[model samples]
Target: MDQQNGVQIEDLLKLKFVSDPQLSPDGKRLVYVVKEINEDKKYQSNLYMMDVATKKVARWTSGKSMDINPRWSPDGSELLFLSNRTEKMQVWTISASGGEPEIVTDMDHGVSNPSWHPEGHSILYQFTNKKDEENGPIIVDQLRYKADGKPSLTSQSYEQVAQITLDTKEIKVLLEGDADYVYSSYTNDGSGIVYVKFEEDEPESYIQSKVYVYEFDQKPKAISEIKGTLSHPVCSPDGRYIAYVGHDQKYSHATYNELFVYDRESDSTQCLTGKLDIQIGDVMISDLHSIDMSPSLTWSNNSEQLYFLASEFGNTELYAIDLFGNVDKMVEGDRHIYQYAMDDDAKDVYLAISTPAHPGDLVRHDINSLMEEPLTYHNEKLLCNITLSIPEPVQYPSQDGTVIHGWMLKPNDFKAGEKYPMILYIHGGPHMMYGNTFFHEFQCLTAKGYAVLYLNPRGSHGYGQTFVNGCRGDYGGGDYHDLMSGVDHAIESFNWIDSEELYVTGGSYGGFMTNWIVGNTNRFKAAVTQRSICNWQSFYGVSDIGYFFTKGEIGVHMEEDPEKLWYHSPIRFVKHIETPLLIIHGEKDYRCPIEQAEQLYIALKQQKKPTRLVRFPDADHNLSRNGDPAMRMARLEQISGWFDHYRLIPKTSRVANI
Candidate 1:
């Protein structure tokens, strides 16, 4: 084997990523999800068991499905998971010693977010059933609702919570078709189940979600009305409290999330974190490009301390607290840290960390020693001889005098006095921040001889709440200036960046800004917008949460302020575009629907601007993170191709003359 070819694409694809590590009930075998990429570059996830003593790993299932949410049976004899192997998403279980997997329930409708009963004999899951279908509902009349503050009408329907038992094979409908319920977890003694319910105005309304708890054989009761919103209800081990995230219904949707604890008896909740204003959302949350808070909540066995990961003062770290809401730091790193698990005895905690130079690796932290050790040796063999780009943190003042923070990755193998092409990358959520994390896309751009500049503009998280909400009601105003100034600073500060060969690309909010920038000015020679929002007027109606989120963030409701929505829309100025733009979208993306790409492509084509659209099949909004690996690489390659096609090539005649 001539190994100088570096690492094969297949090897990189086959590397397994471990997540959701849970210690067995007896605290012996640790179970976690081992995710690998298939030949198609699609991710295949399965539950695996690892013995702590020998570090021995054994496969628990061999099926053609992505199994996740692995919870060991209380006796540690069986493993429970949620999979799509049966054409519909449902719960399945297998013996921990390895055996044929058995389906637990056969609900015609799909089931998701499964939680095992504390006794491990029963399972609680959330399902979406069309309650109106039994009544034989018809679509003869359109359901009219406001979208992004514009009149939008569509079909109306809803979903609710459900439960099942493994031994009896009996099903119980504890909660049904009142609204949408998701992410249910059982109390320690399995006395009750806590879940989130969205009380919408109609099928298309955007209202904050409410937290509800259902006791065995009883009607569900709304236990807490969090100030902003609540999601992922994980109960503390003692059963006396539930730990969750709380956000302002208006500004919290896009910014950082706040962690809170609720007392079961008092019916009162307390914010656990006062130092940090935001909790890092999930690496993957929604089905589409929109971002939401999904704070990983775990509790110590004693139940006195609840643990979570949040970003405080611009750094993401692991934090813990007591039932009284007193917070303490657990683990701190320079980069983004998450996916933490406490041991059964609550003596040790394991975390997955990723820095600017490191992708991600498993690390174990001792609760008593306060020491951390590397648990897995991955990527070391692949990156031994490879020289990668290092992201240098940079900051500059925007037009409005906001001192914006950002990072610049210089081209690999660079030399002085030689100018190279550059790309300005914008992050998706207008509310999200591009922190000091290991980003594959940025690395690839630098490896191809292009300097990359990314910024935490006015609306990005990590900064204070005021800074994060700065872009509200002004999609392309100060936020646009912050981004433009970042590009300008990169060009001025780095002599290697060829100003004329600059390009720009972003998804969601970034995508919106890219389209807006190309329309307002021709600074970027080429551009690519992925899963972006083009027509704000149509976004509310087409997207899953657009109706409420748009009105809250932009201060416009479809029935109230049509003019304001139109003004902030990027599609309105597409006629003035001069840059060569590429549009990439996922077919199944419902947040920023494929129609957003269609509208931009058609508009750019109509204006005679060189434009192209690359669509991914069955992919959602987060095509980069959980999307097919090969497709993601292809996207990066295509982006490089677009910039290369428009790059300023040196004249051969000039070389001959010199």
Candidate 2:
């Protein structure tokens, strides 16, 4: 077979991103979102349906805007989805057979997370209270007054749960207050609804939320009393139990969310996966999916077992846990199950799977036989002639002797005795794992004649809780050594790598590490940092979750221990940076905030260091993954060009080889 061309940045437009697979009540059909780039270079997600028996696929929506969060009606006669077809996101219902979608809600604020009433007469959705006037001076009195990619809060606007009747289209506020309410699910008996809300009107209150059951015509009752952030409440089929995913915040945000069940009769909660030592829920990262929906716990019809997705060893697999605390891995592999929807019978599952070879495709898995059948070929034609770099799993001992897991991709069109530049790629989240899933950026680097090295450092979640929390309060300490050692091991093990022509780059936490690496050493010829935090003091106030994130990750509050915060910040050591650096940030990135990038870029320029800053307008923290297609491509090209410009050349010899 002839070697085809490698993947280019422009090819992103041709690839189809799939997500949010939901099964019909009868389990005969599957509804999912197929996100593709439009002529305007913006993403447009439309609803697609698949026949479970015949494997036939068809588009259910033809909207020019995003049509997502598709939920099946109780009778499976209509599909309720959130669409912005009218220029504002709202609940829209379409016949299951495919027809014109009817706008159900006309609320001023956009709606999300739509759930149909078991009776199929009304819909429960979430939307923030919009101010009466549109144009006015902004005034913020709360600590968390602004969120990334959202309008600045001039007045307090809390996310409230509401219901809209299909017949009259009359909207009624089911729950309202200063606190934000997120709709989870209705009780099995349909007597009340379950949701997660934070009622304390304080800055610190944003870090904690409680699961509540709001009974009709009654006050809400708290089900779980464990002191930690809780979410994804799911009532059992018999209404005797409630299952949710949460942690005790023992390690703060570094703590893995464990699956827990609340016994309504006993009035107690138990951690079902206490011995699993894995993070529950979807932790897989992919650029193919515009929105990675949270994992929903599915209950067996008998109500004896619960099924959910968990991250272990860099892979997200489906697992089942019984009421007796016995856990079983239903699906385990090197691939990533980004999102899955279980049938009502709980015997089959529909998954959005991504492997090292392909971006993503829909598939059906049998719970008993574990057999998988592919359902969609959205990216088949595009990938037919495109060569992808397959990653080889590599493991090495860190500086502290702890084993670290990683993957390395060799440059495309490799030849014997040929040397190529190497790039070390670090993942963000610090808690997120760099796993077996396909990474377009890493492949792009290899396509440009550069070997790529990516790994799950100490703070990554695939390992146990201890390993995931090992980097806390020790940023740039053990974790830094782990990354550096991985690079050293890669160069020593790969004889074709040009050790002298090394480059480093990462985003978010990885961006912070990139800054720290360049500031601490000059070994790499070039470095690129994206949406990185440079100062903890400012980050604590400006970032959406910084107040708690900094305290939890750094193990100290800014006011309590300013010295420690500054000690770990990379900006303090900027005077020592010697590598040619490029900074990339999204203008609307409130998680790390664009100021984080601006501060670093300005400081480096003041010292006359080789640096450039590229900002993407109308983009948030997820620019590289879910931002505008044009901006994402520009980001890839910028990073590639910056490294190429500063790449070192191998020494030449006059003698010719025979």
Candidate 3:
């Protein structure tokens, strides 16, 4: 492999993160956010506007702050976005022409989910007031309390939807107390907002939202009748229908989200993506971009059809659906459209796309002519000099003959006759699929002469609902076999891979699988488990979503069957592990918790097994995706160094440092 001329871990600085592309109401211009690390190696995001016809680009907003969630004004004269220039993130308004910004919300804590009225007379946003108290004894009484990034919020907090008039700057609380609301441009003719709310005090409530429209003139009316998890509800231009993405919990947490439309005229609701068998969101894992890209269901200008993105096979593509549920894939391509903005007539769509070879760039797709033009090649200069590896899609049969889909990335300087070390990379979400997208870590590893194999086993999205739910009660059974089969198929198809130097690594659920793989087999020379779970019984009581996720995936409660939980625990089979394992975890991670990694490290150390635990301080479950820039580079280097050290020596030999 060409180690010197390829992408390096520090290349993270050279990469520019382009996201949240928003088309002006007139469709003559587009505004987007470009995020990059500064002199201090800290992230700073700003807004930039581009002229559609002339391809002219100019900076719209600038600062050390992170400005995000850009939205166009109804009249297209101004832009509204969230910024963290102050002590906290708040809504800020800037003129269409680039200049300084004027603060909109003057809240002390912070605000989020900002939207404009149809007339642009006011702004709607969500604000939560902190209830500070004197130093006292901490009391616990809730089941659903902790979150991933911000560990525990033992104190009760409720987000309220509020509106502020631009002219007088007067604030009014519309929907308060336990209601989570998001506004649309003209929801209920600018007199109200569309929101999703779930009362924590409700019967057996565990975070499922109900959609409603809260009109200032009228009472809040329930738009969704089904008991399910819902998000991003938007109103049609004519205000005749409300569209949202959700699932009725038919398959618990493993259910595929379907696009549901609610007709205001007929008072009827229907699911549009139920038959598509594709997940209605971008699940492709990437370390380049922030990965929060969507209006999962973007309505067309005419309101006759809705454009949406879904994961299928090994890529995410765009599709349009009409009222009759006639879904048509707008076009076909191997690229991932993480963000897009359609024109007023829905004739031209601006896409922020990422491919196997490209980090991110902008492209304009003309719907009428069925032609696409590359709008911006922001990363071309940096990427051109680097030897980027492209992912080759491959499918293999599982133990039950079920075909598994994945991608194999060869080393940048791959040669047909030479043998290369192979690495199996697993994804975090048991429900997330590895797709046709650019993964920085994979490129870095491949540059070091390792072939990377990533696959979507059973319990992964992109596959059907049955396949996504296949590992509900069988974590180490079929999904385990599917991954092993993928590795076998990769080596079988490409015999040049040195199977004796194979390695495995993953985060979260992928980490659990890596641990399970070491215990179940001694094939891999080394394994790296990150932010993983070891004991299901302890995980059920420790993790943030443990109370439900444990039973939902394990198909049994701790009280119902403790033995079943232990049987699936990776620690139970630690005595059988032969491969040296490296455990990485975040100290403040509430999703999986550091205790999970601590348990594995302690057990392995007690047995004098070759293992090391690296803990990241002040980091949570999201450390890998959006962690501190310096820590992210260290994490990559640590994993690569461990694997390279183990593979460099011969069998039955150890590194002198170890």
**Candidate 1 lDDT by residue in tens digits, 1-658:** 2333222223446345656677777767777776767676666777767776676767666655888878778888888888888887889988888878889978776787777888877888877665344455455333332122111222343455667987789898766764567777787889888888866565544356777777777877876665446687788777888777767655645545667677888888777665655544543211111233456777787888877776644456777777666777778756666476777776777776667766666677887897987766555665554567887888899998999998898888578989888889988777666765666667667877888888888877777778888989888899999989998888888878887778899888889989888888876778888889988889877886677668867888888988889999988887777677899988877768899999889887876767999998877777777677777667767777877777754323111210
Report the C-alpha lDDT of model 2 over 464-492, residue by residue, as the tens digit.
99999999999999999999999999988
Q: Which of 1 and 3 is the better model by lDDT?
A: 3
Cα RMSD for predicted model 2 = 3.4
lDDT of 3 by residue, 293-322 (tens): 354677776788898888877678888999
RMSD of each: 4.7, 3.4, 2.4
Give the clashing residue pairs of candidate 3, or none: none
**Backbone clashes under 3 angstroms, per model:** 9, 0, 0
Of candidates 2 and 1, the better by TM-score = 2
Candidate 3 regions off by >4 Å? 1-4, 151-155, 179-188, 202-204, 293-295, 653-658
lDDT of each: 0.73, 0.85, 0.84
Which candidate leads the pack in TM-score? 3
Error of 3 at 157 (Å): 1.6
Ranking of predictions according to TM-score: 3, 2, 1
Please provide TM-scores, in order, for all candidate models, with all chains considered together.
Answer: 0.88, 0.96, 0.96
Please give the lDDT score at residue 446 for candidate 2: 88
The full ranking of all candidates by lDDT, starting with the best, is 2, 3, 1
